[model samples]
Target: MTDTPHTGGCRCGAVRFSAAAAPHHVSYCHCVDCRRASGAPVSAFVGFAADSVSFEGEAPRRHENGPVARSFCASCGSPIAYADSRLAADIWIMLGAMDQPAAYKPTHHAWVREQLPYVHMPDSLPRHVKSSVPRPTE
Candidate 1:
């Protein structure tokens, strides 16, 4: 990964952020909660050390959803990041919110049990029936 800092924000530019380090992992999530929150069949995210990320402008509003604290832009309601107590050391940023989203790529699919029937993915990558932190080894 490039040493260049990764930067991005919400749709309205009211919530901006920068990450000091490149993501440790990136993946597509097919969990029901993620699908509903993102209004898509799946959502992609980048994992980073919790302390590596910092917010600028208006901070994202946090919504407590079970064990995960989902953050979104209060001004435009754009999904931002998620923090789970189970994975307290890391913060997962929604890939779509990144300024250069193509810089990252999904390494696997998580929560495949909830994946929509029509959603097709390559069988070569690792897939988990439920949320997989640290990823599920083959």
Candidate 2:
């Protein structure tokens, strides 16, 4: 685990959060589901152990996306994080919501088959047809 502090908030500044440890992994998901939900080319995220993060101010508004649940600030509509009940100990935070996004790097590109034609993926990172299995470290 890396000793890096992670902090972020909603667009309206109503909801704030901080993580004491570095993320388990970061990635850009190009799946159609992600594109529709985020209304962007790809959805970037940083994974962390659920217990390692702390929230302050107002809680996020929850939305159910199939098997996963996403949370965001109701006032500003800033995508905050995705929580999976199946993966009880982990939470996926939106990388764009981070205050210091540079501290994290995408290790992989997920749902490559759904990626837009004009969107070029870096050759350096691994690409997968679907959500990759979480490694033991993650």
The prediction achieving the highest lDDT against the true structure is: 1
Q: Go through the candidates in order and give each one's C-alpha lDDT.
A: 0.89, 0.84
**What does candidate 1's lDDT look like per residue over 28-54, in tens digits?**
999989988889999999999999999
Write candidate 2's Cα lDDT for 1-138 as tens digits.
275568988888999999877788798999887787788999999998899999999989899965589998999898999887778788889998888888788899988888999998657888888885453332
The superposed Cα distance between candidate 2 and the true structure at residue 129, in angstroms, equals: 1.0
Off by over 4 Å in 2: 1-3, 134-138
Model 1: pairs clashing at backbone N, Cα or C within 3 Å: none
Candidate 2: which pairs clash?
Answer: none
Model 1 residue-pair collision total: 0
Please give the lDDT score at residue 114 for candidate 1.
90
